[model samples]
Target: MGARAALRHGAARIERWLEIEREQLVLWLPVMLGAGITAWFVLPDAARWIGFVLGSLALALAAMVLPGGGRAPRALAIAGLALAAGCALIWWRAERVAAPVLARPALAVFAGRVERVEQLPARDMVRVTLSPIGHADLPPRVRVNLARADAPAGLTRGAVIKLRARLMPPPAAAVPGAYDFARVAWFSRLGATGKGFAPVEVVMPGVAPGADLRARLSGHIQSRIAGSGGGIASALATGDQGAITEEDSEAIRRSGLAHLLSVSGLHVTAVTAAAMLLVLRLLALSPTLALRWRLPLAAAGAGALAAVGYTLLTGAEVPTIRSCVAALLVLLALSLGREAITLRLVAAGAFIVLLLWPESLAGPSFQLSFAAVTAIVALHESPRVRGWFRRREEGRGRRLLRGLGSLLLTGIAVELALMPIGLFHFHKAGIYGALANIVAIPLTTFVIMPLEALALALDMVGIGAPVWWLTARALDLLLWLAHITASAPGAVAALPAMPGGAYALIVAGGLWVALWRTRVRWGGLAPFAVGLGWALVTPAPDLLVTGDGRHLAIRTADGAMALLRDRAGDYTRSMLGENSGAEEELALLSEAPDARCSPDLCLVEVRSGARRWRVLATRSGYMVPWAEMIALCKATDVVVSDRRLPPGCIPRWLRLDRDTLAKTGGVAITFADARIRAVRGGGSHPWLTPLTVQPPFAARPEGGGRATR
Candidate 1:
């Protein structure tokens, strides 16, 4: 009797909770779609087709039974259908964008017409996208980088150029769970990336009106405002970031002001609002038209047009497109006298974007942009918040103070919402981002952008120099703030790679908290806290080996990382450092007191609690004698080399050589409980090379190797 009563009570509680959330069900549609898309991306290639077929069948079954079922069944059916549609959408998108990827690295002479040219002023190089004229094997588009000196003079869009170049396929992730450059390049239709050799020549030059305009505008802006400030202004005006110095870019990113350059919601909203206000004022001057016409509707239409124009002018990136769509929806809402900002509006924008570009779901820009907007909207829409910020008759000083307080609170909420995302993608989060944004957002939106527009308008009469000077000074101040904030102690909190499960937990919990208005929403805090705790307690990998077998990072007993080579490039060093969660510079392994080195290889011993790992890694391309190799392998627990090893040269635990690394891509190793575990990266995704078949490893015979008890 007691058990029956408890069961009945639990069932009743769950039923009540579901009833409360019933009204918010519609808001979960985009979340379900994103889940399905994420599923497609993470599943193995072979499993994707099977999963899609199963989902389709489920959808069909649900549709057939939906009409005859009760409310619960109908809701389940709708959710199932949405998930299936998401899977189908992503699969279709991937197939539609499929292009031939370069299979191998090569050096050859090729002629092609330049489709686009991007200047890299900081690096003194130019990157041009080309349409190969005669290379049937090459994909439709390829991007090549050339030194300014080697590039032909007057290289522009539509100019045909010939050059000898070293070309390679798009690169894969540096390690498992890192950024996948190949996936990005695949979606972008770039078949190969290369650097040009000398003897570059231009075959012909053709005119491109739009490219010329953009180039002229960027050049004009840069010439007027000197230094990195001009680069920023050009980015804002022309969507060309090539002129921005790398140092400034880093500082801006660290300060959380990088969004200013992205030309998203803030910029789009500003442009639309300005256009609407201008039209309203102009129409008001003509009293006859103002009285006869639907002036607000006309203004809305004008604002929509301006939003579209600005989006196109800014290259229509994913975030820009999302902002444009949302801005248009807002205008539509105003014209209909309906609420302009709501969760439904955000959902609609996300739904449209996902339908058009499913691949973007995997990119950080899409995730961060939508997440930020959703969080802000949810925060401001809370009943308590609305009542607090409600307009009341007050003194100017009090009103101004309230406004500043609102801004600060909004900034803090956004930073908190974006923290997990930033850490997942970048391995670091800006601690002072909220404080930095409080000043930077208003400065960029009101002061710098207005000055820039006025200067551009005055340039028609060549009297823009003074206005341009003011713009530059304002930009200089913004830059100064970014530098100061970024350079502050503890400004950046760097972490090791976050596990996918933890990230998923945080995102799901965050959505639950944001989407629900009921007291039940507080339950979400449980999962969010759990995920943060999981991330905090996770251990960094003890060993990191690059996919190419050219670099290795080993964490010693002191919790300091040492590199195999001191001459590793900055990118390689940084990646390794981030992955290992190293806070200081990495020392060369050969220089470490415990490491023994020779011309051919370096040997190091690492201790993990009661167990010790012996590692031998090749340092050069020189081939060691087969007998010596076997002897060396016998003494080590793991062996790493850039060259292929013979079948008999197996280590006690693992062997990673050219052949294996070609298959695994990269490997991260961890040690615990007297055992070693290795995580390798390689998938059958379209962007990755087709993996070669190899026989599985057999355990060593008894007495063939020493045992570590």
Candidate 2:
């Protein structure tokens, strides 16, 4: 009886906590979605749509059957249901875009409309995105590299053209655990990418699908404005970064103003707010309209319309749509004269963006933009901040000072809040971002954005040259400011790679603390500490293997990563050099201080602690005797070859070749106390299958049988 009473008391405590959280529970939907996706990627099974559906159904059943005797049980069940919902949504999305993949490079000849065109700066060629002919004939969409001499001087969108191109599968991850190009390509609905050899045919001509408004707007701006001014104008107006040069992009990044380059929340919010205020002033000037009708409502509606126009004029990506949605919600609240709720508005935006593109959960733009905005909203809308701002508005002079202070505060909050995420994805963070914003944001907000908008407006009437010139002058100043600020000490700092699950956990903990309005929210710091600890203590991999198994690299005692080969394929060399993320050089990894090497083969001994293991690396020529191969395998612990070994080779020896490397994408070997273990570079992604291995063979069972003892 005493134990039962104790249990009841504990249950009551949990119930009260749940009640405290109920008001803000909806905002946790993204957290649930992120958890589900993380689980999907980490799970060691080949998940199909049928499995996801069944799993969702099972979860739904469990939720329905769960006892309602306690609030704790109900809350747990709801969490399960949310996870199931996310799984079902992602599975459905993946199935809709799945396409047949090409296994080898072949000359594919197909005639289709060109949807997008980008000029290759280094080569005198144009890269074109061709529409899919059929779901089965080729990939859903193909990017063809066309030599400029064989085609028209300029190829705009929607030009029907026939070309011969060497087509291959969309590339997989460039390095083990690096960016997954294949997954991104799948989500983007691109099936193949290649270079066109001979392209000399044009069947028809029309405007591009997305270029109807952007093309006309960009062309007018370029014609009216020249040089970097026109380039910046075109980028801001039409969401084209290709017009900006590499040096300008680098300058912007170093200055901590790369956010300005993208059409995101800041640009959208500023443009819509400015348009609304202008409309409101005009409405206020009409005495009869202002007194007789709801001028505020009219202005709000006009603002929403402006936002829609801006969305269409610029690139309507996931982050841009999310900002538009948030702004519209705020306008709706104001028009109705209802109190605005920040959490609900953010929740709605997140729901809509995730519903449209679930894969965006993995992108830096969505995470950083949302995190910053959410943190700012939480800070500015808090009671203490509201009271302070109200006090600051006591006089006209104070109001100006308050506005400047608020801007500075906002920049600080956003930069600090987004620091961990930037570090996780880019392995770098800007220390002087807040200071940079002080000089950058005002120029952009007051002078640059307004002037660019006016320039576009004037271009519609063919009188844009004067305004374009002013805009160019402002842009030059902005560039000069960027160059100065970015050159400051500690402007940007580099970070090492994080451990498994560190990024997800850190983000989730931040959300937990930000979404709740109680002092108990401090508990979120525990998970954050755990993630940071993982990042600090986790040792990087010792050995790097390529997807093709032809090249290998390892970290040496002298602290520079060393490669096994002096020369390798471009992809292999790049992946190894980049993925190591440490001080690296092109020096070869040799077993002995002085090693013997021939054109076809090289022998090296790798020393780890008290243990030593031999490694045999060779180029093509499987025609070598099976006995010689067996002896080489017996003498070495690892065998990396350019081509596949003969069927008679021993399976017990650890080996990687052209035939078996794709299974794991790559592997990282770790040696501790002379015992070696391997960790996979590629995780569970739909584009590349989940990797599984114990050692000697990672090939299909039928192929492994040939080398079995």
Candidate 3:
């Protein structure tokens, strides 16, 4: 009798809790849909069809149960249906975007029509996207970088050109859990990338009105502003960021002002709001029109038109399209006298974006943009925040102070929300991003963008020089602020790659806290805290190896990373540094006193607690004798080489040569308690060649083999 009473009490509490939260249920639709999309992306290719079949069955079951089920069962059924629909939608989208990918690297002469041309002023190169002509063997589209001197004259979009170039398949991740460029290229229909070796020959000159206008505007902007500031102005006006210097770009990113360069929600809102206000004021000047006409509706229509025109003029990037959708929604709400900004508006925007571009869910832009908006909306919607705004009126000075304080608080909330995403994708988060944004946001929104627009308008009548000068000055100040903030001590908090489980925990907890209105929302902080702690406590790998086996890094006893090659390229070094969580630059292993080196190979001994391990890596292309290699492999615990090892040349612990690296992509190794643990890279995805099953490499324990897969 006592057990039955306790069970009944627990059930009642759960039922009441569900009843209290029923109104907020609609907010979870996108979350359920996104879950299915994520599962599709992460699942193996062979299992996708099976999973889809199962999802369809589940959807049918849910539909049958939803009509007559209890509250809990009905909620579960709705979630199930959304999840299954998401899976089906993404599966269809992937098939729709499928195109031929380059199978291997080759040097060939080909003719193609230019689709787009991007200038890289910093590198003195111009990258052009082309649609292959008369070559069924090649990919539908390819991108090639040509030196300024090698590129032909009148190289613009729609021009037919011929070139001899070396083309390679889209690049994969450099290290495990790092960025995957191939996945991005796959969705974009770009199958290969290459560099032009010979001068491009122009067969015909073609005209493109959009490309020509953009180029002319960019050239004009650069002529008006003297330095890198002009590049920023051009980016704002035409979305051409190719003119920005690399150093300035880095500074802006590190300082957390990078959003200013992207034409996202902030820019869209500014343009739309400006247009609406202008239209409203002009209509108000005529009292007859104001009294007789639907002024707000007319203003909203004008704003919508402006938003659409701006989005198209700026190349209709994914972020721009998303902002446009949201802006249009806001206009619709205003015209109908409904609340303009709400969580529902954001959810609708996300649903539309996902419906159109499901693959974008995997990108940083979509994640960061949506996360920031959701956080801001959740914050402002809180009862306490609303109460504070309803306080008695105050003096002008006090009102100004309150407004600034609100801006700062909003900035802090957005930073906290974006931290997990930043760490997951970049392995680092800006420490002072909230503080930097407080100043940067207003300056860009009020001073720089408005002045830029005004100057462009004046340029049509040939009196824009003065306003253009002011725009340049303001941009210079913005750049200066970015540099100062980025140079500050401890501006970035770097972490090693976070585990997927921890990342998921943080995201789930954040959504729970943002979506719920009851005190139960506090429970989400528990998982959020645990996820952060887990990421901070996890140990980084002891050794790193690139996919090509040409570069290697090991953490030394002094707690510094040492590299096998000192002359590695900047990109390779940066990637190694990020993955290893090294705060300082990597030093050459050859400079270490404990390392021994020959012309072809270098050997280093690393100690972890009481266990000592030996690592031998190739230093040059020169091949060592087979007998010497066999002897060396026996001596070292691990052997890493760009070339394939000879037969019977296995090491006591592990061997990572060309054949293994080709399959694994990259390898991260850890040593502890007389055991060697290795984590290999590459995944079963369409963009990547499927990895074949292989026999486990055996590591000898006490002269007997222990297998590792």
Name the candidate that leads on TM-score: 3
Q: After superposition, how far is residue 137 of candidate 3 from its true place, in Å?
A: 1.7
> What lDDT would each prediction earn against the true structure?
0.82, 0.69, 0.82
What is candidate 2's CA lDDT for residue 4?
89
The lowest-lDDT stretch of 10 consecutive residues in candidate 2 is 700-709
- Residue 440 in model 1: lDDT: 93
lDDT of 1: 0.82
Cα lDDT for residue 364, model 1? 84
Q: lDDT tens digits, residues 1-709, model 2? A: 9998997787788778878878777777666765666556555454553475467557756756765555556555666676776666776676677765555566555677788776433244567888855335566577777665655643678787775666777776534455566778877777777776553467777564445667666766666666555666677766666556656765677677878877877788888888889998998998999899887788888889988888877868777898899889989998777776487798889878877888788778888888888988887877777777765327788888887788788888888678877766665667778778887888888898899888778877888779878998998887877778767777765444555588766776777778887777788888877886776665655566666666777665554566666666655654565555552334565542434456566666556678665667675453566788777777777777767776655433467666766565656665543323333433444565411111121222221111100
lDDT per residue as tens, model 1, 1-709: 9998996687667557667877677888888788777877777674775677487558757656744344455556667777777877887777677788777776656789998888777677889899888777667778888887777666888889887666778888777556778899888888888888766788988575345777778888899997889989988886788878888988898888887887788889989998999999999899899889999999999999999998887778989999999999999999999999998899989999998998999888998899889988999999998887778999999999988888888998899898888888888788899899999999998999889999999999999999999999999999999999989998887877888889888998899899998898988998898998888888888888888898999987577899998689888888888877775778888888878988788999998888789999998888888999899999999999988899998899889999988877878877664323233333466666422221123343333311111
TM-score of each model, in listed order: 0.92, 0.84, 0.93
